[model samples]
Target: MTIVNLDHMSTNQLLPEVQKAMIEAVKKNYGNPSSQNAGGEETLGMIEKARASVAGLINCENKKEVVFTSGGTESINHGIKGVAFANTDRGKHIVTTNIEHNAVSKSIKRLSQLGYTVTSVSVNDKGMVDPADIAKAITDETILVSVMHSNNEIGTIQPIEEIAKITQEKKIILHSDAVDSVGVVPIDVQKLGVDLLSFASSTYYGPTGVGGLYVRRGVRIWPIMDGGIQEHNKRAGTENIFGIIGMGVAADLAGKNMDKRINHLKNISNFLVKELPNYIDEYHLNGDPAKGLPNLVSFAIKYIEGESIVLMLEDDGYRASTRSACATGSLRASHVLMSIGLDHADAQGTLVVTSGMENTKDDIIGFLRALKNIVKTLRDISPLYRKNQ
Candidate 1:
């Protein structure tokens, strides 16, 4: 069976160029980046090249601001926890949205246990958090504000720049979990006005297990990991050299071909949105229709569980997701869906579809056709559908 991946948010296939780069790096078998020998110096050069490339992708003015990590989770943890620990003398209060990824939420939760105060501002029905709400949540004790650049579940892009102004005026630090946004969309840290931003290589066709955290010059942040002075002392331990090389190639390609890649993704996503009604009924679109990510579509199909549909679609060679892959296997209704005003039933029935540069319009059409049948099969036996009927 030919599989169509509509779950790009979870695992993006590495680009051919990225794969080749990784293969080449492995063949070379370079030395450690920290050593002073010629082999180590060569490895260091390659690492620096990757850093510059990744920095270019996010428009970080100084490449030194970029610190490599294991992935998005570590980057977020470093950004949130590091800043929180470093700024404890200033305040123990933090601001964030209700729809943040688990990395941000759990980090803040841990901090709360350590005597820190938190104010989680809620988003509107469309999953867009108001800048005013964020401002209102801020107080004199608020030291940092960590809002995701784009929501993983619904794909709603937040107003980071507007919120950045508030943080800037108040002399508070701002961090953005841009794991899902950095490579999928154009991200300029300078323009976004964020002191710290976390991103993963997998989001941009790079290999998994390698990511970066952008710490603006002079930001008060401590290293989450302690040991070597690698990553400018922001992160410790040996780097994932193979993955970093792949990420560098992927980042460069993403920067040079972003417009073309986005166009491809937008075409398929737009087709899915425009044709969804023709294939299925009794469904509501989630997220801001006009402002969400160009490559993602979320639908709340009534009267059936999303997992049932996902499994049934998989049998038909069409893969879909019910929520963030990181939150998979959890029986609880999505906090993100609930925060966007979705009731229990609709939230449980939510389906998240994401496209990639490799996905085509026909792929989306085929998936929709498969989904229509699956939804019918599930709803035919659903007690909710029967009662509603």
Candidate 2:
């Protein structure tokens, strides 16, 4: 088979304008954004501007509410633990969904060990958490409700706006892990009604190893880490100057081109759904197709392991994944798929293909063809498939 390499989707392909911004950052490597020197003052100004840029992208009321972190995981930790610890006196109970990224899940677990009561609300077969369920689960002792805006594996977008409203009426804090939705989808912090939102730089074509948390003005959250008085004393660490600059550039680019990018992703997704199944049989789409990320498509093929199919697709030059990149190390089936009512075996066979600007119609067609051949070969060798046949 003549394979086209589609694996390793690069954000550079999505944001060519950021390259010059990154280069400029390298040339202006001044240390200690808080230093007394003029160079330091300039760096500090740049950092503040980046913060405002990020805050503006999310419709945050003020730049002071934005705190930069290393990435999504750190941002989630800050939101979960920071809120839980800061409001311990108010309550020891926290609510979140079962399908959250491990960053939020693990943070909840860590807080549980530290004597906090964590309540994990279940999602419907569409992988959406019912706002009523969240409202029902909330107790007077419930201090926070952490839900993801979208599922990374299956692309199921939760009702964060409704959830936020429910939390607010109850006078509880609502935090959303908006990493997947930040760039690919439109978000207004006020519209979403979330008190604290987490977003990653890489998801929006920014450089990796940098992310930010949006703490709505007047929301109290404790610092998860202690060190230099950076990020408005909310997060402590030397600023990632280059990465932050790249993030700002990326956010600006995304904001300007968001509508066009969304349309492109939607077109590619429609093409895949309409075409892929014609070539590949016995495949089931996962999650709510109507209410998911525009750029993400997840499906499960019977008699084929998801990871095996991903590897085969990679060999054919298609960059895809079996589940959330964070959950790649785990051998277990994806919790997201399971939450959506897929059986364990079906969930284990799930493959997620997320589109970026770099992906073309030819790319999707090539991936579909390769996937068809791979599934045929795998099914031919499988005893279960043979029996079914």
Candidate 3:
């Protein structure tokens, strides 16, 4: 039985190499990284090496600027909340887009509850946010601007570099949730000019429980967590030694093969774009195909449920997602699709297919065949389809 995995954005399978690294980290260097003993020093070296790998993948100039965290959610919280709490005197306003991942959106919502003002700029019909809107949203009281480098749901790549210039000109802080972009795209924090960036380890086939936030050198953001001196007192707790080691290896490996992986994703996704719409009538691609992430292809079918399609794919041993994994069990329609001007019915029929390193052409064809059949069967029975007919 050949099973095609299309849900890599939610999580990734741990690579064999990453597993080996994690084992070596625990077995050979299992000591508290904070300890002054020799084992601790060895453990510290391993962790730093991993940090360097993450730095290399993201083109971060200094490893110390990378602070380890639990995962993407935590990194975003630290970056947004850290700056919001630390810079209240500077300004109480923040700017972001309407289509941010739940992490950034929810974090800003919390900030608003704390009396910090928030302006959620809108995205155009193509699912792209304009730099002009971001600039317009900024004001004297605006202390920070956060944006996603690339959207996970629709694969729309935001203009972070341009937005960064706006923030830099005003001396305001810019934070990017690059959890979906760091391992997949060529990220150079220097070029992006972002003050803070967050990405999860699992995005690159590393362990699930670890990730990091890159706080550009000399950026003064308050610590969200406190108790220990870990993460240079920016975050405090015992580090996930094994997970860090695995993430470091994954980051290094991603840097080594990023071009190859990206090209593969594009090739496969292009195939999907050309053939997918042919099978289902009134189906539309969701994002800007040329500029979006190469790995993801999302679409909407008329008068159908996304969940039914996902379940049918799963029954055939393929995995797909209707929305972000974080939003599972919530019956609400995707906010992303709605923001891009999709009505509730159009958004309800949304289907997202995200490619990964392991998928083959045969897998793609098979998935498409199954999808066409399922959509036909579903629409054939749908009362709405009959009424429209």
Candidate 4:
């Protein structure tokens, strides 16, 4: 009855090397990065090195463009608000996708409440935002277009480069919430033609509560947090010295092994897709299987509650998820699933399983075996399932 956990969407398993780096950073903590003292200089040096490492991960030419924040949510807030505030004179209209994370959606809602215009472009059944749709959404008043690089719930990889081209041609700023895509997938801001990109350290094996944003040089953005000048005056607050250092180490590891990890996850995912049908009946795979992150798989088991299935799996020792970690407490259906054309009933039955380095082929097979039994048990008590049978 032992269960295998398959809900590692937030981050990959941390390697021993990463753990060692974090310990070293904790022991080397010197005071204020802005202090004029020698220790301050050392802290500042560490912070700068971390900045360079982050910049290198995204192929950013200038390390000064990267600004550290608490995590992806904070980075998203700063990117959206900072750009919006700085470009108010140009236009108040902003563009984004309907499937964006709450970080982007809530921020846009707040902006709309504040008297700014916002446009949420719709996605197709595959949860993809068409770049042409983004171009059409643009107007003379459009100043920024923010699209996530990948959907968190369904693992749909958006057409960011095409959207970037359109935005660049129109002189509009393009930003991507790459929190879900950065560590698991390869990213290059220059190659992607993104004006701004946001990512978190935890998404790739670094510690939580630390993230960063890449602002293309010459892009004007106001500081969201007001305090002592730090992060080249782009963001102002006392830096999380240890977190930043840990992020540096994690980024280096991610960049070095991204390709191998991606391939490994792909193998694991393919096995799941091939074997899942043997255990469960009448299920739907969410999103485009061909164009998704290697480690993520979202599916809907008809006539069963996602939460019930998650709990059932947990009881057996598995740790799968019902939806985005942010939406677990809510009763409402997932916005991402709804955006991709799933009805409320189908959305409620959705489960998102994302793999990490710690997961293995045997782990997936074990999960499938447990999952099949759980679904069968749940469907036995469901009136709808009985009627369908």
lDDT string for model 2 (191-215, tens) is 9999999988888888888999999
Which of candidates 1 and 2 reaches a greater TM-score?
A: 1
Lowest-sum lDDT 10-residue window in model 4: 9-18
lDDT per residue, candidate 1, 18-115, as tens digits? 99999999999999999999999999999999999999999988999999999999999999999999998999999999999999999999999999
Candidate 3 structure lDDT? 0.91
TM-score of the candidate numbered 4? 0.98
For residues 135-198, write the lDDT of model 4, one tens digit per residue.
Answer: 8899999999999999889999988999988998999999999999898899999999998999
| RMSD (Å) per prediction | 0.7, 1.8, 1.0, 1.2
Please report, in order, the local distance difference test score of every candidate based on alpha carbons. 0.93, 0.84, 0.91, 0.89
Name the lDDT value of residue 205 in candidate 3: 92
Lowest-sum lDDT 10-residue window in model 3: 275-284
Clashing pairs in 4: none
lDDT of 3 by residue, 315-350 (tens): 988899988999888888999999999999889999
Candidate topping TM-score: 1
Please count the clashing residue pairs in each candidate, in the order shown: 0, 7, 0, 0
Q: At residue 129, what lDDT does model 3 achieve? A: 95
